[model samples]
Target: MVTDRRSEFEATLTRTAEARGQEAGAALQRASLLRDAIHRFIRNRAAVVAAVAFVVMVGFVILTPWLSHGSAYGVDFAQAYKSPSWAHPFGTDEFGRDLLVRTALGGRVSIAIGFAATIAIMIVGILYGAISGFAGGRIDDMLMRFLDALYGLPYLPFAIITLAIFGTVNFWTMVVALTIASWFTTARVMRGQIITLKENDYVRAANALGARWYRVLFRHLLPNTLGVILIFVFLELPGVVLGEAFLSFIGLGISPPKASWGTLAQDGYSAYEAHPYIIIIPSLAIAWLILSAFFVADGLRDALDPRTRET
Candidate 1:
């Protein structure tokens, strides 16, 4: 009797603990849903601020050329290397072209290149990561080996070789270079996330319900991972911009006649003794753009992390 009573007591205790755990889990889920909703609803007031700044910056870069009466390329010996004045704000370069116009054009190229490269990286990363993670086993092993092989190679050397063979840094080439060099990092992060997500109860339940593989992967897995993906994308932009600028700085980027922040900076630095405005203006623009992206990204990192609010 004593033994039977002891076993019954133990079982009752176990059931009581499990019941409390379920309740706690439900409470936690409700709290998490509430927090996520609040974060979305507010939309990071800081990001809203950044959205405004980004809009103004984009407008200035894209619209100023159309708005101005004179062309960016129009040269006047009289205005060559002139100081910033009421008539010619941002001054003129060595060729007497409008510094304002060149800088604006440069901004357009830098931002555009960054956007293109980042998109390509994200697409490749998402597909590669999701597929490998879901398939797992030998397929995952083979795919990861390929990824590791690429990662093992020296990146800068590879970039230099690829650019040298291509012999141009036009729009497509720039996109290719950035995409090739950058996607691995995204792929690794995404693979880890997929591994964690694929094991979730909902994903298993979907599989058990006879849902098709593609539908389950896309409808259930992708949507759930979007928040994480978005955060990474924003974080990646600054790195992309910096890479474009560095490539341009080294003369391996968007070639002359087309301006990029790096090319502009290169020109400015070379002529610094004679033309201070050229370097100073473009450099400042690059600084501002980078800073704006970084600040917004930082705010997002803080707000999006689930543990942040809990702590």
Candidate 2:
């Protein structure tokens, strides 16, 4: 009887231990899922760096007007063309204006233009492409052909002609010029994505169920293509900023009294011999902005690409 009781007790203990083992295994699985999510995010170091840089730069630019000492437009011929010194950090420009102040304010214009042009470009591209791609057949061909014709026009030549005809490159004019040329690339990308997505099983099911065309495209297609669109937006921003600069440099960008990085660089060119800081400072700002954008874009590419998803 003693031996039988001992065996029974051992069996009960074994069952309890087995139950505890199962509970521990379940806990481990939960922890593993959490770990996997964290690992996925941490794996993309480039993206993290880019994101951080962008945030810092953006914060700096937003606070620029308040951070400057003298007015961006305030001129002092007395301090004209001063080199970098304690009184003038980035020195004075040809017109005796503070280079640092102007550069700081210039950040607002450059960043604003980038965001404005991109938003406009994306809106037009997404709408036109979504419609054309959903319609398909002759409608798609016709729309694409029209876009192709527009694309064939040289951007520089057209910009020059418009500037000459307008006789002034104002803020709105710059936006218009950029908008005309920028949307084509986005439209093409969106259309291609839409084309592939329309034939997807879910899309087909939605169609079969008599779902509205707009609903199908906007609700289903747009979300899937969002990653691609975001990637393109980051990739294309530098180009827009550079284009704005080019126009400003050539006297076809923002008019004087309204400083842009490009126009500022142009202004500093004549006095670069005496005030190297004037040129160097603006040039460096532009470089940093472009480089930061590129880094953020690269990071987005890695993060968004399916091939690198596992990494």
Candidate 3:
């Protein structure tokens, strides 16, 4: 009986050592992958430049309100339609509001909407997809069919309807509208990924070991989908920004006394013929942000690809 007990203790020790070894190996592999991804991202010059530009742009918007001498809302009729000068580098709009300050402030609103809406999309999409994929059978079919029904709805119109329902045109309102309209695609992508990942050996082993559903889903499945999720995030940002801009341009987004790149464009449109800088400046800002985001997304895609070699 003593010999048997000793053997059982030895087996337990062996099992514990193997488990530790596996955990250590996984940690090492994750570190190596992260290191390689960073190296790959750094090698992409366009991505590096774009990233720097994006950060600079974000900082410029965040700090502009504090640093600018002029107010975004304050009007000075005497300064109206002035060309780019030392006092106002981006010149003044028709109302003599400083274009530079307006542009910067508008950026804050636009970028904020983009990030907020994207975050909502990620949470809703990831959870819905994971649950549907993991559950499968009738539930999967029902959820997918509902998603398909949503897919048939037009994006802009749906957002507009949602906005109308909220009875306001503000930051949170716009975020909700965009989030409601945008989560469908993300959900589809995540669902496809989860469906494949759920069949992997690690996931099966997790189930076999009696791990809870949430643990298997969150700890095991979700982590594996990070690369795909990150790529989608960068790619989605530009779209959300543009969408916000479009809504604001149509007067359905940010209202008067507040600004967004889209609203700035709209304000500048009529006066563009007389003072092209009004429209040109904001348009260029929008283009710059979109291009930068796209480059970063491209870099992330290549970096995270397992097939990508160090060469």
Measured by TM-score, the strongest candidate is 3
Colliding pairs, model 1: none
Predict model 1's lDDT versus the native: 0.78
In TM-score terms, candidate 2 sits at 0.83
How many clashing residue pairs, candidate 3?
0
> Please, what are the lDDT tens digits per residue for candidate 3 over residues 1-311?
99999998998777656645654565587678889999999999998998998898899889988898976888789888999999999999888998899999999999999999999989999899989988899999999999999999999999999999999999999999999989998898999999998887666756765679999898778887888899889888898999888888888978889989999999989987889999888889999899999999999999988899655
Write the residue-wise lDDT of candidate 1 on 186-223 in tens digits. Answer: 88888888889788766665565566889868866776
Clashing residue pair totals per candidate (backbone < 3 A): 0, 0, 0
The TM-scores, one per candidate, come to 0.83, 0.83, 0.92
Name the runs in model 3 displaced over 4 angstroms: 1-24
Better candidate by lDDT, 2 or 3: 3
Clashes of 2: 0
RMSD of 1: 7.5
Off by over 4 Å in 1: 1-49, 309-311
Candidate 2 backbone collisions, by pair: none
lDDT of 2: 0.77
Which lDDT tens digits does candidate 2 get at residues 29-148?
446544553455467677667667777777767775687675567777888777877767777876787777788777778878888888888999999998999899999999999999
